[model samples]
Target: MSNRSIGLDGPLYDYLLEHSLREPEILAELRAETANLPEANMQIAPEQGQFMALLARLMGARRYLEIGTFTGYSALAIALALPEDGTVVTLDKSAQWTTTARRYWERAGVSGRIRLELGEAGNTLQALEAEGETSRFDLAFIDADKTGYPDYFEHCLRLVRAGGLILVDNTLWHGSVADPDDTREDTRAIRAFNDALHHDERIDLSLAPIGDGLTLARRR
Candidate 1:
């Protein structure tokens, strides 16, 4: 067996999806519609969504928080995995994109379980904290602006309960975090975020090489 994660070529990646991915029809439809958008890259991969849903199911997650709701694909994934009493509070600033997301969430019959909050995510997070929401969620997913990751993470640390999971998307930043010369704004932000989390003792961490990159942080 390989000691490191195996590189996935086009053929291999296709094979992996064909053999393992279980993207539901509604999610597939949502993915298809999102693929036409200019910011389609913002959407998480199907496999990544499935993987996250599995995590929620395994954790028996009931209260989930999402910082970004791009087309609501990831939120829908987790919503499906949660029980009838489960709820998802997803935040986003884009009305147009989230409109598409809402339609699909309705089609999937999980709209009632998901509450969409529209506004600046940081401000909303602060409001949640002010509303006595400390350590209240079972899981939190951050996938919004790269620069806002640090602030969002801090909010999640408090919003997510002890021993809960906080998942950060695009932590590897399309592999740019490894390039010493790529000093771009978002790249730098992601790098700094990763570095801080590396030495952070409050949570157990692992950066999985899936999609852009999925960072799993389990609060201690």
Candidate 2:
């Protein structure tokens, strides 16, 4: 049976975001800018951002990778948690979307910390691997196209160090993963990925019912 559970609703999610997330002035501005975007819902909740930041800090992550940078919210969150010398490599295919991301990243004063790679995510990952980046990253977050999730997972597994963490977003696919009737390609892909990871010995995995669901895999 599927292990996914119901996620946050109106009051609780709002309360959590309000209480736990402390957005800096620049980040607030970035959020406002992102609010008008068509894919604004793709932005991670403020609480989720705080969670990622805390995880990065706890793991002492210096080198980070993000497969999808919508408006740079998650990247900024993780960047804020990193030390002075830390850096993040963020990838996205759309120059149009990344324009917004670049602006926010610059506004957050984290442009220096982030290297935005504009192109196909798979090719970028392959290039990074070829550049001797395999097993070098400290943390990786995959939140791009749902259909490319498995590829992203494989590449991230290769790029993240043995003890690194891989955070896969939208693992629940908005409750579709549990409904056998809903066999859309995206849901099927996520289901396959989740099943494969559940039995994989390379990582210690846990699927949390956070916003849309987040799968945390710590490389073993």
Candidate 3:
């Protein structure tokens, strides 16, 4: 058996999902509906949602922060894993998409636990920081604009308490990160962000090969 993570081919991927995935009915419905959208790829994979939910439970996460809330699948997963008192504050620029997210959140009966803030995320994050919100969150997830990752990560670090967790999505960028010839703007940004996280001294980092790629950073 290999010591490292194995590459998942079509059959292997299917096997993994069959054996490991445990998606909720509502989440599954959300996934199916999102699949028909033009920007459906922005949705996190079901397995990734499960994994993040596990992370939330393991960390005893209560106050959650999400930088991107496209259709709210990830937020819902995290919310389901949390206690009734736990809450998630999610930010997104699209009222249209988040409106759909709110509908599902309400259906899941976790609407009261999720606070959606609409508008430019960067400015919103700055406002949070300006309001003395440093070290206020237990966990922060970043899955928004690729170009804004660095800024998002910085704000997330500031918002999370010492020893809190920060989860960054799309770190692999569909494997374009490792290809020297693939210098797309988003690719370059992800690559640069990955490198910075790799060298950052304030956090413990792991680049897990889940859904495109997920980077976990625990504040030190």
TM-score of every candidate = 0.99, 0.94, 0.98
* Per-prediction backbone clash count: 0, 0, 0
Give the worst 10-residue stretch by lDDT in candidate 3: 127-136
lDDT of each: 0.95, 0.89, 0.95
For model 2, what is the alpha-carbon lDDT of residue 29?
79
lDDT of 3 by residue, 11-67 (tens): 999999999999999999999999999999999999999999999999998999999
The sequence of per-residue lDDT tens digits that candidate 1 reaches over residues 14-116 is: 9999999999999999999999999999999999999999999999999999999989999999999999999999999999999999999999999999999
Q: Report each candidate's C-alpha RMSD, comma-separated, in the order given.
A: 0.7, 2.7, 0.8
Candidate 1 residue runs with Cα over 4 Å from true position = none
lDDT of 2 by residue, 81-192 (tens): 9998999999998898888878878877888989999999999999999999999899999999988988899999999999999999999888899999998989999999
Per-residue error (Å), model 3, residue 96: 0.8
Output the better candidate (1/3) by TM-score. Answer: 1
lDDT (Cα, 0-100) at 123 in candidate 3: 94
Regions more than 4 Å wrong, model 2: 1-7
Q: Which candidate ranks first by lDDT, i.e. highest? A: 1
